[model samples]
Target: MGMIVPSLAHWLEASELLNGKGMFMTGTDTNVGKTWVGKQLIHTLRVLGREVIPRKPVESGWNADIQQTDAWQLANAAGLELDNSICPYRFSAAISPPRAAHLVGKHLTLQTLAATCPTRWDKRQFLYVEGAGGFYSPIADDGLNADLAQILGLPVVLVAENKLGCINHVLLAAEAIQQRRVPFAGVILNNRQSLPESMDNLNDLRAYLTVPVVTFPAT
Candidate 1:
């Protein structure tokens, strides 16, 4: 049978780009499958005999009853326990993390968030960090996700929901990342919904983007 998701080759390329350090995963927008792609990447790295450490640092829209916050899911993907070390700032409001932090009389800073990520890297160990929303979305009281990406200095993997207008979103985000001079690993177009085969969003993106443009649920 054909591969149902991204091929091993794609993951291998990603691994090489990461060079055993890890990647900062962001999305073009919320619900663009950043967590989903991060989980898959973690799994693929494990299959390649690499240790994966996943971090969600800060998450909004957290509900203890839900038990499925982004941080929880990321820790689960890495086979680690849910703890403050993995995610230190979690708010109940379903808004930008900085706004959510404000709702509870908390203030977050880019430095504080960046400090949560692991600095030490061992051979065959990967550290995966997922941002709260889009690349430019506000993540701290003082910075956007782009700012945090600059601080961490890890290569970025942008995930965009595949559908109408994704080309614009992907390109705009790519330009922003380029402006920041962050190492852009690639773009992952997640198929959250089926599109007409004639749409060919993948090729359209590849035509414009110089970086690798891969599709989830590999078309």
Candidate 2:
């Protein structure tokens, strides 16, 4: 589908709904620029004059500061001063949330994560919930990101970063979303796959996924 505006700019416009609603940003897989996309969403909202707080329900592994995860990126991009508890669960291991949390001797619950989010229309400028890993990524022993989104009752914006395997991953994620009865806003394709073989499959993906594919090519 054709884009209405740059992804970030479009998210800036979507921030208007956050006064009474929230937005869930999930991805097709890990390392798919999910952090980048979530940050842009918050940054756009802040630029649009909204006080937006970005969050990652569950994070795993840290390069240096354990607290400086995806949530930090969003806060930095949005220029918002958010306390560490704004993103409650910080797990180490750099793996899927549940596994990473287990490795770090921390167990996270979706209900707690959902409940801990900064709620209330007046309390927060806007809430941007970024999922750990992908829609089907495990947040708890059995809970997935879709479960988190369902509890939040927010429209999902899926981020697909792979070029070749994206269509399959996207369709799988859509199925998960449907199973959880969550509303999907659309899918954004992080256009970083440039291998000739991978590039050859881009058009194929554009034709297959049942949702709009918003591509963010490498600059």
Candidate 3:
């Protein structure tokens, strides 16, 4: 599909509809710091006195002892207690949400995934919905991460790991996002490792994509 970049007016309209309180965070690839960046954003928003509700629609590779799941980490970051609203589907296996659901004898549908999210708008609390794995990663039997993001109708914050081949990944993710006509906020480059090409990739991405590209230092 041909990429179609939306005008500023489109984003403005979405912001108005959402009451300027919702966004989707998706990564270029797995372990690309989507949760880490999300945690930082939640912390920053909380510091600014905004009540933030973090959601990871589906999570895999659950750890019982540490409660170490993407959704748990995000919920903790927002200073909110854990609940189904934060993460609807969770699996112990380390795999994609759809596959994990399949292994558990449960079918994943886009409708079910959408229904698990917060449908009502709350003026006081901002919503940060994080997607599992990469932007194109499958979350349901028929839908990908981008589809879930589209269904939520929230602006997206694309996260990419700062490393080799990151430029291609970020650009590809951005292209898919553009083609979907999703309200894109911008991109965040997470420096997971210090590499010689880190700064170069950051600059190349800034020059390649029209959207604003920001960096997240190692934590």
Question: In model 2, what lDDT does residue 8 have?
Answer: 52
lDDT of 1 by residue, 102-160 (tens): 88899999999999998897878988899999999999989999999999998899999
Q: Considering summed lDDT, which 10 consecutive residues are worst modelled in model 2?
A: 11-20
- Give the winner by TM-score: 1
Across residues 1-219, which tens digit of lDDT does each residue of candidate 2 receive?
A: 122336556533443343436678888878899887676556556655667767766677755763366767776766756566666677657787778877857777778888767667654477778888878878877688878888889878888875666778888887788778877666767766466642544456557655455556433
Give the TM-score of each candidate: 0.93, 0.80, 0.87
Better of 1 and 3 by lDDT: 1
- Each prediction's whole-model lDDT (CA): 0.84, 0.69, 0.78
Q: Candidate 2: where is the Cα deviation over 4 Å?
A: 1-7, 10-20, 65-68, 195-211
Winning model by lDDT = 1
Candidate 3, residues 1-219, lDDT tens digits: the string is 122223322322433422477788899888888888778777666654568888887888877854567788888888878898888788888898889888989888888888877787668788888888888998899999999998999888898987788888888889999999998777878876778743577678878977777667622
At residue 140, candidate 1 shows an lDDT of 91
Winner of 1 and 2 under TM-score: 1
- Segments in model 1 whose C-alpha atoms lie over 4 Å from true places: 1-11
Name the Cα RMSD for model 1.
2.5
Evaluated at residue 124, the lDDT of candidate 2 is 49
